[model samples]
Target: MMLPTDPAQNLAKLIRCPSVTPAEGGALAVLEDMLKPLGFAVARPTFSEAGTPDIENLYARRAGDGPHLMFAGHTDVVPVGDEAAWKHPPFAAEIANGEMYGRGAVDMKGGIACFVAALARHVEETGGPSGSVSLLITGDEEGPAINGTAKLLQWASARGEAWDACLLGEPTNPERLGDMVKVGRRGSLSATLTVLGRQGHAAYPHLADNPVRGLMTLVDALLDPPFDAGTERFQPTNLEVTSIDVGNPATNVIAARASAAFNVRFNDTWTVESLQAEIHNRLDTASRRRKYRKDRKEPVEFELAWRDNPSHVFLTHDDKLIGTLARSVEAVTGMHPALSTSGGTSDARYIKDYCPVVEFGLVGQTMHMVDERVQLADLETLTQIYRRFIGDWFGSR
Candidate 1:
């Protein structure tokens, strides 16, 4: 079979793999074959942890002597919910009405396919970049992220590998190919707050302290005065209560406990320790306030537990990487993509510690949907953008 040159074809081949989260599912196998022909040294490392499933990741590099550039992405995708709901089989790679439909079509096997195609095109036209180019592709991005880019970067850096800049091909475009590029991401902090109280009869006036009332008081304080006004580069810090529960089944019973879980997506104005300090301060002050029972003056007993590792807010300021990608996008699509720091966290969070990193990729309107798909036209357009970026980036060096 002739080697496919178009990103759409490459995307089709990738979509044919069933590489759902935490599963290799032959996706990396397909990539290994493609990169080998381009003279890339590909390494597949399977990383494992006690609780998390072992993840197979690919790190491919074509050696050169100038500034090293790395492209980061994940081959693993979220589960295709209700496969029968799709217009075509989720893994069939069916092309219909000018769209290739399948799981990972846009979030983001599509991005990976485009980058590889662009690399191939770059080599054919200019005989490779002046500097080394590498890919930190992971299969655990959609899972717990235990054995993925975080460890991979550590592994690579330990071996004296350093990157001048990194680009994450997460689906950044909200609507169209040249619409947006992510320069930074907000930090995320999740926590569960539980308030303890004594169970009592509902009819009693001064019998038990209701932790539900205390929880409401705290939640109010957390959300009332906004964390901060919108910053120049990021939105205002926002906290949301995800769950509030009292386990008591009977409505007449005053529950012994009430718990609430909340998450805060914050900007650079605060660090994890500072933000957490603010939360504790709020809880401490609120817990001491008067209860609804009026006579009971004892403070609310509460416990707070953090969930998952909090991601630190990060911004990329590399002129070469940002300028090259921005210029390339304009040249390819006649639109200057907006430089944004407005999105949920991505693997770039991990890559940021290693090097300056940015994110740009396919339009993501259909990601994680029933018929996740990518437009054939957008695939080539993004490929051309990446190809231009490669030429301009390496040429500038």
Candidate 2:
């Protein structure tokens, strides 16, 4: 039996599967085939929610007596926008100028591929590590996250599965392979704000209230007086207004309603509940301001609806896990990696509840771009880094 020791070969097979969001696209099947040959016991579980599409997830365990290590990632890729614009077919896994072109190549099917190759090489050369290892992969990361990592973690915990540490294979580097390793992530919270008013002719200003004016006031309140000064270990919280909509097509009429959607990437300064309270307070105070409605005497009538569950902030404190992975990266790439917490939220937010988790993978300069590609050299370097981390982590334990 041949081992899947080559990172490029493993990645090509994965990229060929068009496993776009909510679609298996044969990606999980291919992964199962690769893991089975390495003596892993794999189980494919399908999870469902009311409005979300049923998603398939994989949990494969190669058991041993020592502390368990979990490798987590997703096989799904975002849809290719304008497939004709790609230099190479998105699913063809074409190689040109030493870089492989495909969807999910760097964000992040490539990460999964290198980790699998590292494990394969370890099994072939050293009969594997002394500890157990498992891969918790989900197909729903790129889609509605309702049935993805959060629920998967609960299901696994129900079955008595536990881990000492986790290394999530998310693309963490900004410019080069060893540029950064993510040790923490800011929280994410999203909400929609709607202001209600009466519609009337634009010329009849006194007969109707313009909700757009009120919306501007509320949005200004949210943006001003920055959330907080920079924290010691985390950046200051920031909020972005993603969309503002009124749905009015007429030029001479005032719309009856105006709404805006906003998301906040917050640090440890506030919890979801406290943040919600602060936002409510800001809106409450702003709604009564007469600056937007000088003639009106009443507060702005508005509704605030929070979208989905909020992702809480987290930071890993495990020295062994962080130090071992950092050393492995520096040893292979000859550059010390920065321990950062600067990117957007990921499935690591969910994994952190179970055990300490850190993220490291390939350089992510081209992830999610029209021509998503990864250098063949980076693949080998990342594989070596992961392989080294695996051996050292288990040996230290």
Candidates in order, TM-scores: namely 0.97, 0.98
On residues 212-255, what C-alpha lDDT tens digit does candidate 1 reach at each position? 88888788889979889978999999999999989889988999
The lDDT of each candidate is 0.90, 0.94
Instruction: Give candidate 1 regions above 4 Å deviation.
Output: 1-4, 291-293
Top-lDDT candidate index: 2
- Flag clash pairs in model 2: none
Write down the TM-score for model 2.
0.98
For residue 136, model 1's alpha carbon misses the true position, in angstroms, by: 0.4
User: Residue 196 error for model 1, in Å?
Assistant: 0.5
